[model samples]
Target: MTTLPDSFLSLPIAHRGYHDAGSGIIENTRAAFRAAIEAGYGIELDVQLSADGHAMVFHDYEMSRLTGETGPIRTRNRDALTRIILKNTDETIPALPEILSLIAGRVPLLIEAKDQDGAMGPDIGPLEQSVADALKDYAGPVAVMSFNPHSVIRLAALAPNVPRGLVTCHFPAEHWQLLNEKTRTRLRAIPDYMRAGASFISHRHDDLANPRISELRAAGASIICWTVRSFEAEIEARKLADNITFEGYRAAVGTG
Candidate 1:
């Protein structure tokens, strides 16, 4: 297993590195990422391929939700992708490698594999391999996680010891105990996640601070909550889990 950085394992992550500055630069852009690094928070960003197979920093499969582009991200070339103005900022889409280099040794990164409409996981291996290859000699901590746990298990075959987090939503109240043999069969083999080396559990904000979270922590799983937008949510989330994933890293982060 790769030795994570000293403060790497215990720090909160800024989701897409604090992009909403009312400046037009949306999440996953170079401006946002730079803001994150400068703020000294760990980074968590997503990746998808351009039309020509270049891995670029982006979170969703379609730009319609975040960027107002009605097409899939993969349909556009790098230049084409970069040309779309970020929601508020003058910045354009950013290349993953460029973002990586900008962060340098500043903080840990969680790179998520993304595809439009959730139909093309099989095509992710090469993209996964390419991203991993790019970060091979990276001195800072790095990990790849997906909401599709199968992709994580698949990536395991090629990249061993790379930490993966099981990204889930609306986690059941009984997340720690293994019950219901049927759902167990269909689920991503969560035990396999622990067995394979998932150091963290990333769940929605609502799921934090529950008994199940305590249970997972008892099992040595690091609990991380997602997209904390408000000060109240941030305070409460910090009380429940080991780390939090926030989208608004733009504000001066104090205490919790």
Candidate 2:
């Protein structure tokens, strides 16, 4: 299994590229990524497959939330998506290559491939291939992960040399309504860590105390937590996490 780089564990990653919608720096847009790069923070962003099989840096499957446009992001081709400006910003939706070129290895990058199969089942591919293609020539401290184990498994095959991880959490039914009880139960245990060849996990901050997290860490998996919004939460998350993926507040370098 490929190990996650030190930079990923050391840097306080910017969730969704240090995005602050209040500041017009929309998540996964060029402005947000540039801001994160300027702040010297590692960037964590999400990608979805465009209709044409290109990887687009975006968090939601639907464009309505970020772009104020209608329909699923995959319903639009890359060119069309690129033409739609993000809400409250001049930046258009960026392709994976565009963001990769913009960052140019300046900071650690963490890419999460959103599950194309709403149920997080075996249906996955084109998006993983697109992401692999984008990173084929990228020289950087970068890693790929997903909440869906199948996606991580696919990434392992597609980008064998690139470090891979799982985005894990206790799948609370209310928050994970799309996933069935059996799926949630299986995922909560993170049974695919070995099968996916994952070197690390970015678990939900509140769920850091889960015994499985400690078990994985004891077995050599790096622990990372997501969406820490304040210094206090960062402090709490650090008890179990090797690093944090944060937004809304500046994470002091080297603070525990």
Per-residue lDDT tens digits for candidate 1, residues 135-235, read 77776678777765556666566566676667755434365243354543434334445544666767778766456567767877776778788767878
Question: For model 1, what is the alpha-carbon lDDT of residue 146?
Answer: 73
Report the number of backbone clashes for model 1. Answer: 6
Q: After superposition, how far is residue 213 of candidate 1 from its true place, in Å?
A: 3.0
Best by TM-score: 2
Each prediction's Cα lDDT score? 0.68, 0.93
- Report the error of model 2 at residue 5, Å: 0.5
Q: Supply the TM-score for candidate 2.
A: 0.98
**Total colliding residue pairs, candidate 2:** 0
Task: Tell me the deviation in Å of residue 42 in model 2.
Answer: 0.3
